[model samples]
Target: MYVRHVAAAAAAFLGWALVLSGGPATTATAAASGESTTAAAATGRDPVRLVGAPVLYAHRGASAYAPENTLAAVDLAEDLGIDWVENDVQRTKDGELVVIHDDTLARTTDVETRYPDRKPWRVADFTAAEIAGLDAGSWFTPQFAGARVPTLRQYLDRVRFNQQKLLLEIKKPELYPGIEQDTLRVLEEAGWLGEQQVENRLVVQSFSVDCVRTVHSLRPDLITAFLGTPAAEDLALYAEFTDRINPWHTTITAEWVAAVHALRGVHGEPLEVDTWIVDDPAVARKVQAMGVDGIITNAPDVVREAVGGF
Candidate 1:
């Protein structure tokens, strides 16, 4: 996993370099007033009319710049005026909901140094308090030496305080049975679901189809997305519950996107399509041209600037 992270980070840097060599994107929001007043106004001339702007979700809370799933990363996304930030949730050994990505704590935390004997340091092996004690940011940079793991409550508070929306991902939820219910219970306690406008501000997504079904069955009022590639039959089945079908970039195409657009959704909206981890300017523009409504990116600023929109 650490090897994968290094490879991804290196690729991201190279993509940025290629983007830098180019002059500037013609449809960038800076020229919003040149012809069409806003990104929405410009969409009519294109293949798809999105909700408002090109929706950009700061993948893993602007993970490209700051440590992923930390307050520092989320705050940086907010500071950049990004409307949406994404995060992952997993349970600790004591069944407490904490925000982190991997099933283990090797790449982003000091778990190996702190507990050398614990091979394959699974998150569920330690209590939340014990998990919280590890330094989460120093691995990224010394400037962020003391960042700690945040509880789900703290993560929700940060998102709410920023006045931003969240793409809440239930990570590896199958490992902890009934985590879907536990997640909703935590959100209910946080005033994030079941009673107010907060529900509208969240889009619950999961790679696990079972987890997606759990969220859909439990609270259909809240938006839900199915992440990863799904079979054609699976897509049709999920269309009943999921508001969006967010596949990987590799699986998406113009025809697939158009087909999804034609499908009627039970939620009274178009079968919204979104895709992830796009960073290069050329790729971002291609995604937009493919009729994708949203772009989930680690490089939020570049996507919003080069791809042009929110």
Candidate 2:
């Protein structure tokens, strides 16, 4: 969670910036008018209307309250009343896809203790069965000691059972060759490729431009997002294949959100911006006021309350 802590620190700094500029609520509310006026000229289309508070996505399933990418995390997010959950998917040596964040297993699981000899326990180095035998949740708390890493199939079944929406990230696709095709195969077999699921319940996202394009080409029906910001001039090309632009929260501003919203996606709907990894309420409200369409966070419950109060 070092990176999460760093993001939170950055959020605090941004919150401070909001205070110096004037309160986030008042300043952004006042800026909206000017932003709207220039929005069309900024991107060659009328501004996409800003919705209410941004939608909250449980980053790796309310990870602040549960072990990330575990079934427990998903269940906890559901318990928190968050319908949208974001998770990372990687492939094991046996070609089975699993829900985990890092290329290595040392941080989120008891891998080092389980296999002390396996120096750098990369996720792709172990077979799925080997990974399944390791405890994934004990690092978070003893209460979750036995929580095992979930296979993508198991993860999908659980999410479907809960009737939750998923922002499924294709984490580091380069490490796992042909993972895009492999992932589509899984989503198809699991019924996620169906019309309703594609339209409503799923979004496949990746930081890799090639991977995003590949997913778009393979399943044009499925909504897809690019995880990092492209150049302003590049947004049009991305909009041809991607539906949303999801950037690290620190990089977002009202102007950037407006720029993204001015373009139409492959589906003919205005492109959206969903900023990532913000866990602070002040920062949450700041981004909400910036007109972001979504906030992906480790503390979904807190953000829900924060944005609601704002």
Candidate 3:
């Protein structure tokens, strides 16, 4: 029954794309005016019209087509018309931010086989160079042989050069002592932190309120998203720290969406709600029908088609 629902949703999204062609003309005009103006205008109930084209966020840089969290994956997402490239950030032994989804490096890389004696905590003991030496891509596919782990700087540089927006997830802040500082420093060094204009393009997200709060305090203009599956009572605490809430799709009810929109940020504006890892078209449509601001997924092309027709 579940599989059948997923297929029907996927099919519906595919069929919907055939009906819609491009983004709303109003949104294009708004994007041209600048991020602040556009974001401000979008705050209204109508905001920037989704016009059925859901915001396409490339989950782990389009993991479906390329090695997750790699520069190659981000590039492929850009090529495929993805609006935002999402990636995870973790600190290396030397206090540098690197992009990788897992802390152990077991599932995505050959680290486990190469260093069986070295436990998962061993990652924190190794320098970035040593960590980078592990083949991160081969495990994903034989075709992507020799793909190495990329530093956050390399990842950000590539994305900036490509003019792509980024959704950066700070992973396990407590485990990495100075990960937040290092991450902030890297973005600053890359000239991604200083100015107001650049800040709008970045969305920093984390499950930890402290992590997101730290970033918000340092770079107040930088958009911060609280990533969690919390009860209604817990949401008020989250709202105090972040501009947006990125809840697990399953946890998001229609009432939750309505409630989230009712709560105002520090600026006295409605909070933006984004749900993650939604790949099925019917669920996507249901979420859209519920009026979610964004949906993150591995199959961005599928979501794009679903939202376009919606």
Clash tally, candidates in order: 0, 0, 2
Question: What is the TM-score of each predicted model, taking all chains together?
Answer: 0.82, 0.83, 0.81
lDDT-based ranking, best first?
2, 1, 3
Per-residue lDDT of model 2, residues 1-310, tens digit only: 0011123234334333332221123211222232331232333322121225467789998788678999988987775567889999999999999999999999989999989999699999999999999999889877678899999999999999999999999999999989999999999899888888988889999999899999999888888999997878788999989999999988877777777888888888888888898988778878876767788998765565566411
Query: How would you encode candidate 3's per-residue C-alpha lDDT over 1-310 as one tens digit per residue?
Result: 0001122234335334444334433322332233333453354223222333446688998777678998868876765556588999987778767899888778888887777877763556668888888888787767667888899999989888888888899998888876777888888888777564355578889998889899888777677888976677667777777778888888887677766766765434567777898888677877765556778888665566566521
* 2 or 3, greater by TM-score: 2
The whole-model lDDT of each prediction reads 0.75, 0.79, 0.71
User: How many residue pairs of model 3 clash at the backbone?
Assistant: 2
Instruction: Specify the highest-TM-score model's number.
Output: 2
Question: Which TM-score value belongs to model 3?
Answer: 0.81
- List residue ranges in candidate 2 displaced over 4 A: 1-51
Worst 10 residues of 1 by lDDT: 1-10
Q: Mind giving the per-residue lDDT tens digits that candidate 1 earns over 1-310?
A: 0001122233333333332324332232322223322442234222222223358888888777678899877887775567799999999999999999998988889999999999799999999989999999998777668888899899999998998888899999879998999999999898888445444578889998889888888887878888976665556777887778888887887767766766655576767777898887788766676667788998776776555547
Task: Give candidate 1 regions above 4 Å deviation.
Answer: 1-52, 194-199, 232-234
